[model samples]
Target: MPTTRNFRTRRRRLSWPLIAGIIMLHLAALYGLARALAPDFTAVVEREVVSAFTVTITAPPDPPPPPDNQPEPDEGAAGDPGRDAVPQPVTGQPPKVRVKRDDPLPRASSTGTANQSGAATAGDGTGAAGSGLGTGSGNTGSGRGGVAVTKPVHISGSIDNARDFPVPPGGRAARRGTQVIVRVIVTPDGRARDCRVYRPSPDPEADRITCQLVESRLGFRPATDANGNPVAAPFYWRQEWF
Candidate 1:
């Protein structure tokens, strides 16, 4: 029992540090409670603890990929996969175009029917075939298969007889053997317009006389072809003085 008492004394002496730590812990707890009761010390302590341990962890950056050694695209090449191939023309087909030939005019059959014979033998005399104004039939009316006969144009005009028109030094008299060509457009109303001397006479007086006659007294019923249709046409007249 004496040995056990000495061992307990030594054990108590060794436990003095633990007892001091416990006392310090109790004193700190008491001080915290007092501060908390006095003010908002628990909120301040929580804010300080949060600030002390605040951390931001960032992820590392990724490395760049290796470059491929692909060839550059050809600018002129057809690169699209969906595009259709170029079309090739088919062989053995003739090109589309008109073929020209120099064929002669077809001749009428001499041994045709009686109607063709009659047509060939229709136009006889009266300057019909020579004038090229015949309609085969001898009818002279303004209808089908007939000839259109226009009325004769009547023209009269006075000439300046006093004017000698100045003869050239070595040439003949300007008034002698003078001729004028007059062009007149005959309208459907039997009236003329656009009348002028297409060919001038040697004498100025003859040209002036021809122009006055054409402007004043030129008249015509509209000309007609074999079809008997009235058509506006241009007519010419040559006036001559001996």
Candidate 2:
């Protein structure tokens, strides 16, 4: 047995419009991809931001007015007589004066008597005992009631007259003619009782020997009062030694 075969065939053709539409779609997609991948050319503009605030300012208050009760100065009172007057200076008390005093003269005679009762007491013409100024029997007032000293103490003889003075070993090296001053106290008998150096020499040995030489060997004339009586007194002795 033979079977019959049936074959159906349909043929479709692409039209020009369909092909153009597909090509235009592909071209549009390619253009969109290019546009997304490529860099954009846009203009860049800088914008500055500014901030504003509101502020309130107030001025200081006005000064207060003067008081109504205050009195004004008088311009006419500037020429007042008391304001132009000169003031007198005050005087102080004067200083006191000092009086001079005269002392009474001393007398050796017992007949003289000084009356101290009044400042004007007058003495006898012979100057025995009145407070008045007159010639007296004594030499002069000792400044005290005793007789005044007439002669002062002095060296009797040359200092070379003393016993041989031995110089120390180093005496030659000292300054030549160095002077030493010593104070010697003499008794009424014209003998030196005490001695001390008043002024020192440049050499120490000279000063040490001065007192010993003055007290041991030096002699002095005793000081005499106005009545020629001997009295103890001090004498200054100056000597040169190497």
Candidate 3:
């Protein structure tokens, strides 16, 4: 009866490991919450910096030119207003250059006349001895002395009738030797006009009759000038009465 009192004993429901795991889970949750809600400690800064650099360009040197020694022309020498005026700058177009032409030769030296020397150069006659230029010859070849006659007109045989000619009457001694000299003008149209007796025959009737026949019924080949133009020519002739 001295030790008869009953004692109650309880069994463990949860282990110590379980209790420890529960405590670790609670610490991780609290750490995550604190990290999410905590203030940021990182710093941010904004700055503007200007950068500068220097650049250099170099040019090539030009060659030196020769120096001019001639003196400039005097502008005031002539006292011309246009020449003395200041030269205006031309910008729209290029400057114009003037070209000069030389003058022609004078009249004295320009014309060359044919002389003896020129004649020696030209031939005269048909054969070698005669085949040299004659004395002073004109352009028309009338030469120098004499009448300067070109081509003399002849009496036409067809137009001059024998019956129309003068009898040239004279004295018995001078009849056959009687001579008549006359000058006639031949027109450009081949008409013989202005007949005059320069030297009459011994017989006056013969002289008058000769002049009349020449003026009325004579035809001539007109002469030409140096220029080859047909013109009236004065002709002289002498006739001996037969």
- Candidate achieving the largest TM-score: 2
**Every candidate's lDDT:** 0.60, 0.62, 0.60
Prediction 3 global C-alpha lDDT: 0.60
Candidate 1 ranges with C-alpha deviation above 4 Å: 1-173, 225-227
Q: Report the C-alpha displacement of residue 208, candidate 3, in angstroms.
A: 0.8
lDDT of 1 by residue, 9-93 (tens): 3433548889999999998998788786965776787789999999989998898898989999888998668878888987887
lDDT for 217 in candidate 3 is: 64
Residue pairs in collision within model 1: none
Clashes of 3: 2
lDDT of 2 by residue, 63-154 (tens): 89987897878876665456667789989888878787776555443443663433343444335453432334233322223342754455
Candidate 3 runs further than 4 Å off: 1-149, 158-174
TM-score on alpha carbons, each prediction: 0.30, 0.38, 0.34
| TM-score-superior candidate, 1 or 2 | 2
Model 3: lDDT of residue 67:
95
lDDT digits (tens) for residues 1-242 of candidate 3: 68887887988689899999999999889766666676242111111112223346677788788798899888767654564677888878767777786654444543555322323433564222232333343342332212323564765733234354544334345657668898987765667778899998777776777777777766778777666645567887676655
